[model samples]
Target chain A: MSVAQATRPPKAPAGLTHAELNALRADFPMMSAQTNGRPLVYLDSAVTAQKPQVMIDAATRFYEREYASVHRGVYSLSQHATDLFEQARAKVADALGAGKDETIFVRGTTEAINLVAQSYGRSVLKAGDEILLTQMEHHSNIVPWQLVAEQTGARVIAAPITDDGEIDLDSFERLLTGRTRIVAFTHVSNVLGTVNPVRQMTRMAHRRGAVVLVDGAQAIQHLNVDVKELECDFYAVSAHKHFGPAGIGALYARRSILDAMPPYHGGGAMIRSVDFGGSTYLDGPARFEAGTPHIAGAIGWAASIDYLETLDRQRIAAHEADLLGYARDRLSEVENLRVLGNPSERVGAVSFFMSNAHPHDVGTVLDQRGIAVRAGHHCCQPLMKRFGLPATVRASVALYNMRDEIDALIDGLHEVNEVFG
Target chain B: MSDLRELYQEVILDHNRRPRNFGELEPPCSEADGHNPLCGDQIRVYVRIVDGKIEKVMFQGSGCAISKASASMMTDALTGKSVQDAAKLFEGFQAMVTSDMDATVGDEMGKLAVFAGVREFPARIKCASLAWHTLQAALKGAHEMVSTE
Candidate 1:
């Protein structure tokens, strides 16, 4: 056997074993933290994951020892810093099965989507053209396109979602027409935890001659993402959502499409030559990347990717699926609780409403018991409106989460019922 | 649990369960809408003024217990009070929720002093004060919607 395989633990029949999961949990320092004199049960990973010690250390080590501006000075320290930064880019590209030249570092998914909506959407979209989006899209995905559409006099159209919260394939296909210039949607709904069929949707959009962008903010943590397999024109991911540092993310765009797109922001690093008369911009990813990048954040993100690579992704997916099912079942047992969106395949999160209390009230009670959950529109007000709910209480899971944490959430929810009953 | 009980006291829960003055006022009255965009809490305050006094005050909307109960109790307190007195109560309620936890509430607050617990939970202060802000807008003849962003 290969040395890597030989050293790896024997595969569990279904997900990680109890001891294995506990060992993994120890990697995250926040797992041991206490809130309100009770052990913290972090159930809001979908909002932003608690960082692993490795990622924290990686960023600290870089800032403390190897801090230098990349691609500028001729000194060895600057060269070393450049090498480390480029190595991080390579790791991000490899993680998505994308070309190194096609991956551009951004300030999380919002900036990435805004980059595309401005650079590509503005360049191609015309008056009377349509940019088709799904009802399940986060505000990040929807608002950028709307801004671009308004600028170009192009119309923004939303594809309907089904009662179960899945993007209705039939409705989506029908929305795509010859006038459609772009299609943007999320790989997974942050609130509902519904995983969309990106490959199928990409194929449909391609048939209509439309470029596709997939929001990977909620997907990268749970799924083994391969941009080549999904065949999407562009994909965006936030490092913070996947246990890395905040304010840093990566965008994977197809080589030809990225090559044709103009520079998003104008600054020093993106130029080939500069003069007062006229300046020339470089081709590929650097064209879109403008100011001094987040070097330490990239390093920390690379460490997070390395940490994830050490774990078997399939087993993690299975473990999260089990937790989602358990959460849904337990939430249903509550007398007045109503779990939203019975999507066929869900990951990471489960959103619900209790008839007896508003989500905010339930969230407050849960907070007192040291459980962290999200209680709001989740930045998808349109999606909340689709279900006719003001807000929902979202309990999200990460790899370190255990069944006991879920049980604690259940008990906290019971307390909410008692207080508001 | 004690902290929670402090925040969601029995009076607050009762007011939330069956809010007083819980409907829109008829025409010839001023009304203003309040919205907390973060949590989707919305309250619309309606009032009928007679000789610069609030002859009738009512509200209609959907929100959490804190917001709903605060609105319910606000209408009850504002009835038969002059616009100036209503503004003073708004100021006192806002101070009670925003002040330090141990600060003494003014006697003018009366039953509204229950919201002193909100000082400990800074995030809920906006929820407790959303209706008061709307009520102030209605009293000022500003029909524009107010948002606690």
Candidate 2:
């Protein structure tokens, strides 16, 4: 089979059957594990995904046999390691429809955004300039801009979201005034599961002469992200959220934008030559990746991408959509339970509140039943404040998740009501 | 189920449902806000001290059952008690909740013994202790909010 044929599964039906899903779940060892003596019903994939055995093996193999410092040693082992690392980079870049030289690996999404804020943001923003963001952004997207705004005297402004948790496009356009130098927002909200119209937002920001940065942390895992198609100047994502190892992610920026920006950090690998005077820096992604990178994490992340490529992403999306619909339908039946948002389109996650119980209390009850869900602000305190909620219970799904798990979650919710009733 | 029942005993659920001394105290009272950044649980504790004794203690905030009940029960126990006794009780309460599951609850804890199950849920120790920590800050006349980061 050709490499493309090997990577891409043949087109199948729109969604996977129950048996096929169960077979896929076997690839993730955690699916069989128990929590608190009961079978674990993991519904917290939005926070971080459970890794498949292939990803784990890839990382373990790299550490155990192929470990070496890349772009440093002349030996065959180092060359082989360099080949694997670069191949991983190429895979990640290809997944996003970006060039290999345009992808720079960092610690995670938070660091990726910070890289742009400190490097690209500081270079352009000035006093009285504004940074436009939506109210549904995670703290990772919001705080980085605020930090840059504080340093550069640029004011940070937030566009409002509708009662249904979708961004108000009219307000977003209105906020993109001449003073707006950069528009940073999330492609998919981590809290509300609202998928923003990235292409539309990018066109609006561009028409206003503002550069756009998208937090793709939540989108990359659930959606088929094409940074080029989105026309976002910069895109950031985390590997851990993609069923890969933690502590590694990528920032996709066009070559021209990257070339114009100064290096985020100065260190050994990033420098071409050094002296007591100023040192010259390497060009492309190397300019930002200081020191040795997370070699094992990169390989593991590539393996995860490969694992995802083997399955039909469209089918996975359909399955998740079905799960979301089922969850919402069952949640509405619970007495006094309120689903937080009603966006026209949502994916992977659903958040809710029970009038009789605090989210934390509800989380505890669910835990006792071996159901795992996130109960907190979900790093979107501003969004929570807009809804007048201190916190909410968030249950997110992944491709490996099944409809029965949603049933288990609904049962857990009923238990929460009974316990706290 | 047993563990959940233990953590959310009838007394705790009742206290959470209708917290005692649930409103802010008027003037001559010192107040401190306690925030649990982890879960966004916020609590404000107020105390009016006169003649080295707590003349009145009240609290107002929003949090989980563990935290609200803790605050409610704390106010009930500290009312009319000497400031020194209140401090001692705070230390004991902290110890009881943080101790191992097998540790014995001290006789001095009295009704506060209901919280012994907190030790089993380490993630919840902060939830049960937020109000107490805020009370400590209020007693110390701290102007800044206390955070269980």
Candidate 3:
């Protein structure tokens, strides 16, 4: 065996058994489903992870039993709803290693980033200022900064990634000059699965007097995120990427910073006082959250966190690492197929190209066999261009994915090769 | 499986491998670029219109098999046809691809019928029609890029 293979962790460790981990699949109803008369093998968790039954049940129960507006109504039901809503916020904050007051609820990572860009970015950035970002950021991370920069007469600069799909730290530090106001980068690349050195990068930016924002949409599900440990000024995440409900995510900001930033939207829940002349906004998270939020979605997301906490996170991470290693070895054996990057530290996703077929065609062939993978630029068109590829087929592994699924994906690629030949 | 096979038939694959009129036309009378941001599929449709007829129609770009084949077949179907006839053919092609399986294929569709099975994959409809949309934009003298969104 290769040294890489020799060092691979065992399937089951001392505490959590492999059987126990496999049993967690039962919580997800879609695990046993069949698509197009074949057993479904989902490998598109990077797009969105499937929710557990507990999360689904929590959302349904909220709608069926505890349906009421929060923070306004005073009746018993309304009070209960308000309590649950706040509890959900607390749950998310706890999972992210943040304080409840520092957490602001938004639609998803996109909205969270937008809120920062529009409110904090507009407040701080001036003419000739720069917003530094990495090349591997999702469009959500890039476009919001572009819009804010355009409005503020600031320019958005990108830090280049290494050939192995990692941020060049020396280059990043050099770019963090006196004029860079904000630096936003992904904690884990959605396409290449490179787990960035967030803490080190944040320290580097802090030394240069630049505040950092970490896009943790892909990392929150796969890794334990502690904002205090990373020392990042802001962290954005999406619930759907973490086996939680869609339309709900949270932003983790330092309490002082969040308190100082202006409101992102204007509405009933976020105001301290309203008048004919003008209005004043509330403090903490309420300042950013403007409207009646996704109450059920927040509750469902908290329930997902609760479910995730039940598992040994270390074991889950190890299992995913093993799966990624196995997938990398297996896929590399395919003829004329090339995995996009070989980052020293990567998570459970792999993006690859086949010489004989376009990514869409490969995706279709895989889909026909009930194997779901994402194709196209995977919303990293700039990175795609950097890699000199129009598109790539991405197979992302979730906790529920197994070696057999990877085998199925490899078989499907063989079929793609034969058909496109 | 049959629907998948029908969507990517041998003829379609052949056109993808060797697309007709695949390069840029020098100093064309009119041209328009097309882009599908979702897949990064890009095509530039160049046309030479004489009188009220399409004297020449060609495209240059890189895309998936369906998109490349659609562009090639469209070049064959539109050349030597009147401008109004090309518009009608665009409508027919659009209807054929976006319509349900039960929708009848028009006899006038001819070679364009190869894309009728695109209805099975709704996401690919944009891929199959990107060049046609660019062609329409070119004929309209609208130099602005066309998008499938």
List residue ranges in candidate 1 displaced over 4 A: A1-13
DockQ-derived CAPRI band for the predicted complex in model 3: medium
Candidate 2, superposed: residue stretches over 4 Å from native:
A1-13
TM-score of each: 0.97, 0.97, 0.96
Residues A16-56, candidate 3, lDDT per residue (tens digit)? 35677569888899988998789999999999999899999
Choose 1 or 2, whichever is better by DockQ: 2
lDDT of 3 at A383: 96
**DockQ score, prediction 2:** 0.94
TM-score of the A-chain for all models: 0.97, 0.97, 0.96
Cα lDDT tens digits for candidate 2, A343-399: 877877899999999999999999988999999999999999999999999999999
What docking tier does model 1 reach? high
A226-296 per-residue lDDT for model 1 (tens digits): 88888899999999998999999999999999989988999989999999999999998989888899999
lDDT of 3: 0.90
**Clashing residue pairs, backbone N/CA/C < 3 A, model 2:** none
- At residue A193, candidate 1 shows an lDDT of 91
Q: Global lDDT for candidate 1?
A: 0.91
Candidate 1 clashing pairs, residues 3+ apart or interchain: none
